[model samples]
Target: MKILLHNLTRFGDLLQSQPALAELAGQGHRVAVACLENFAGAAALLPEAEVILPLPGSRFLAGLDGDWRQALAAMDGYVRHVKEVFDPDAAVNLTPALAARLLARRLCGEAVRGFSLDAHGFRHESSLWAAFLEASSAARGLSPFNVVDLFRKAAGVGLGPGRFALRRPEAPALEAARLALADRAPEGAAGYVGFQLGASATARQWPPDAFARLGEGLWQGLGVLPVLLGGPGEKALAAAYRETCRAPSADLVGATDLPALAATLCHLKLLVTNDTGTLHLAAGLGLPSLSIFLATAQPFDTGPYREGCLCLEPDMPCHPCPFGLPCPIGHACRRAIGPDTVLGAATTFLAGGGFPAGGYPGARAWLSGFDRAGFMDMTSLSGHGETARAVWLRLSRRVLRQFLDEEPLAPAGQERFALPAAVHDPLAEQLAQSADLLRLLAGHAGLAGRNPAMKDRFLATWERIRGLWTASPQLGAVGRLWQRDAQRAEPDLPSLIARIERYAALVAAFADRLTRR
Candidate 1:
């Protein structure tokens, strides 16, 4: 099979999708990728891709400002060229944007998976995992699966050992990177530690002063020099770091391109960075990283893909904040993680010792690893007891994996489900309601094909069930999966009935498990 993947996203996302692409290639399929022109260079890092198509998104949009007809013509020409060069048997769109959906439809018609548009211009999600991703976008904090896992699942790839890595740059690029580093750093430093100075969003960035303080501590305590890294846009942050700390450091901000950055990361002892593209690049290079997650960033979903990487996030109720929303408390999560905490983690990791076993008052620590099923997993190092939200998130993950992957559920003690009254009571009520609705839908589904009134009643009951689950954050995963199965089973009354009964059994079993616990 010739599979074409459409990922019109940024640098970090492109790097993260490597496992999915590699899986497609490993399965004896020829993989081609279509990405934005600006990050086309990044596509070279994916060794699995046999063909690379760079879409002139920026240039086309730039042309639209002056001449709309010319822009359309150029876009059409590019589309034709893509279709002619690598005619794909299947298309998987990793981007959820409208333009990407339309392009995927044009490229492979009904064979497109993930998100795409129908012939009537109606949006469609072709897989259960895709629907789950769509639902996760709305309830961010509740999602327990890593995005890399979701991408592979959406692309119809099975979960396996996540050992995929980026292709290293050429020998010349590596040598140039080494020479650049040698010229910048002082002669007698023990080794280099990277400080990634910027992130894609301000909310996700750690304070520059904190980084400077950490740098100074690492130099004074561990005999390592701090090598600052960022794109040209982060020069201001670089200046701020220089002004804040009196430590000896080398600033390579805006000095190197993507390939050079990867080559340079190979020499680092460790990378201490905000949640950014550089973090992903360093992970791709197999460089150990200690990444800070704040505001809308969390380690569970978008942490570095490599196992044994360290991740830190502020321990706040409002953490992993919703996207595009202003912080109600003035981004206090920024102050939650102090420089001392990070320096300790950095030193501990460097010494070949794991994270300190002590509790972090305002922050949490996690070590990245793969679970038994080879999905990216995080083990908390903070000694604090699990919160109610964490319990629900864990349960949600188990339930979804059981339904989607046929994984077996482990037996747990009643204490595991001992959520607070405030959380448990309402959730129990909602699950009961959902179970009842599923039963009603399943009972009526068999009669729907023969009787018009029965069909109307069955449809109404189904919508009610949808509304009930959609409104509850805890049950939204089940709703999303059920929605996908129901959509796929439509026009077949027996199949739809089977789906409804299966979901009913799932809810009933879950409710029984909770009750027994």
Candidate 2:
């Protein structure tokens, strides 16, 4: 299967999506991905990907003088390019921006899948779905899964529930990286501690002094060399840390591209950095890294997914989403996690006592060597037209109308949407297929799907409720799938009302889970 992973966000976001593309390739599917111009270096980690497209204008949107029109045009160009070249079996929209998802869906046509945040209301999601329905509306087009799981589901492959694994660069690149480090600081060439002092903005960054202290400790106590890495914007910050810190270190910030940095991090024994792309890059390159999260971002999205790393957050009432405001109390969160915690993790990892190839103790070994037999059993190439036709037929707005509730255009409608068809139709097919692939792969390893019966029951319940909702005019039109199916002029309104009960139960179950903790 040919898969196109579209990310119109930041370089960090592009790096994060690498795990998803890897998941597809691990399952033996041909995968290509798009990133903003600046993030092209990160795409190099995805050797399995067939093509890496760049949306230059989208990269511009990440900066201070960002423009929405240029970002949209770049996103459109990337989508059209993928549509013409890959003609992907599935298109995964991984950008967080709702507008990007909307435009990308139009450009990709049908066979699209992606995620949406539950902002405003379910109706906002519905509006998005309406656009999606126009593209490809399967039984349940959009899946409400986490970012990582979204790709797994999109690829129609089961990675066996293991931690995400990133591939190392070519041997020559790796060797060159090591030599580059030795040139930077000859005496501490045995091993170095990697540091990233700058992030996209102040909100996501830790205090420079905090990084300085950590670097100082790594040098004085662990005898580890401190190597600061960041973009050109971070040069001064890295230089400042190198000057003020007690340790002997070199500032490589703003000095290297993604590939160079990734290759270099591969040779480093450990990485201590803020919540930024470098943190993720280190993990992807198999470096033992510790990530310090500011109160503005949550660990659920930014924490290191690999082992041999520690994620530290301060105890604060006003946390997670600072909403563009700096911590008023002099950034206590940064001060609390402390340099000792980072240094301790680094010492334990390099000593090889706690960290292993598979990561920390008890961590499962990563999936390696693409399993041909397992993939064969799970998926087979269908006639190009057969799958495309099936996909096209499924992308109906009327069909998508079953999953939404109320019209998104009236009253409080921001016309927000969820899984747009341009994003979900192709993805759901892949997800449905992933169930089979997961079962096949796990079967080889004496493993079985977890909660199989739960999924079965859920699907059964979902179908029944959907049938009921679709049967009545009231339910079909405004009860369930109204908001998401913008193209659906008429829906079974009564069926939608009937299906509301199921949604209520789902909300209740979700609340119960949250309440239990």
Candidate 3:
């Protein structure tokens, strides 16, 4: 079968979709991609695509410098090319914009996966991936999967620890990049750590001073040089940082193109960056990375899609925000995950150690991904699904404390979650404890519900566990064996997680009965 893919987003997002491209190619289907001209140069690097159509994006046409009719005609010509030159059996759009949704309808494909306009002019998305993206911006904290996996899923492709194949540059690019690095290095300096200073959003960029301090310390303690990396947009900030930096460092912010940048990455011991395209670029090159996710970005959805990389996200209440508007708290996410916090994570990674055994208790641990080949390895650092809700309980204490401490209700009342502990009555005490547990479970649900995949799994697993637990008492002779098997080292995580959820639900039901007593 022939497949056409459309990704009219920016460069970084285009790169993240490469694994899905690989997945498409791996399925023995002929593949072609239609992308914006701005990313055409980068798209030229996809090895799996037999065709790369650098069509004008809807954004460009909407912002045309001349006649709208002519622009429309030009787009029509591109659409004609799709129908005539590279007719596809199906088309998948990874972008979620309304304009892109309309564009998908014009492509030559029998089936379309993302947004599409109906005959009456209403936009619709029928796939789970589409629903995830629609909910993503607002329910930002809910996803347990990364953007890469989400994109693959949207395309109706299988996901696993799939290899993300990017076009490799010629060896000359690597040679040139090494020379540039060597020339920039101070005499007797050790290898460098890349400092990607800027991000797509103003909220995501870390302060220049913080980087300077981190660079100086790395130089003093580890003999590592700081090599700043970013596009031309970061040139001014790079200049300011170089001027103020106490340690002499190399600034390559606007010096290299994509190929050369990949070559440059090959020389670095590690790259510390804001959640940016460069981080994904490094991932493709197999370079170790440490990404700092500030503001609304969370590692769960967009962390570097590789192993041996560390991410640091603040445990701020308003964090993992949607970032739809100006921050009301001066970007407390950034302020909370400060230079000191970043330095510690950097130190741990460079020291050749993994994240702490169970991850940092709260705000100060190495934030991690499951390292699944394409987009994720696990949903949370909650240790292979032992109990993500337990992590939620620990993380949300401050937010849920108010409700958790509500006074228990009297022997007969309407309160289901307000059972106060009684000094004399054991039944009242049990009811009160159940209420507190219910509050904690509700808080965990708040985070677990963000990712649609996890939410689906949680519910499905909840029902399955309920069935098993309910049947356990009926297994007259083998009940103890079933319980013992569940307690082994290789316990069933989904079943365990489901029981935890069931426990919370049961507590609420129990509390409801006590209040009416």
**What is the lDDT for 114 in model 2?**
58
List the global CA lDDT of all models: 0.82, 0.53, 0.65
| Among all candidates shown, the one with the greatest TM-score | 1
| Candidate closer to the true structure by TM-score (higher is better), 2 or 3 | 3
lDDT of 1 by residue, 346-420 (tens): 898888746666766678888888888788878778853366766666666666776665444444445345577
Best by lDDT: 1
- Under the 3 Å rule for N, CA and C atoms, how many clashes does model 1 have? 0
CA RMSD of all predictions? 2.8, 16.1, 13.5
- Going through the candidates in the order shown, the clash numbers are 0, 43, 11
Ranking by lDDT: 1, 3, 2
- Report clash pairs, candidate 1: none
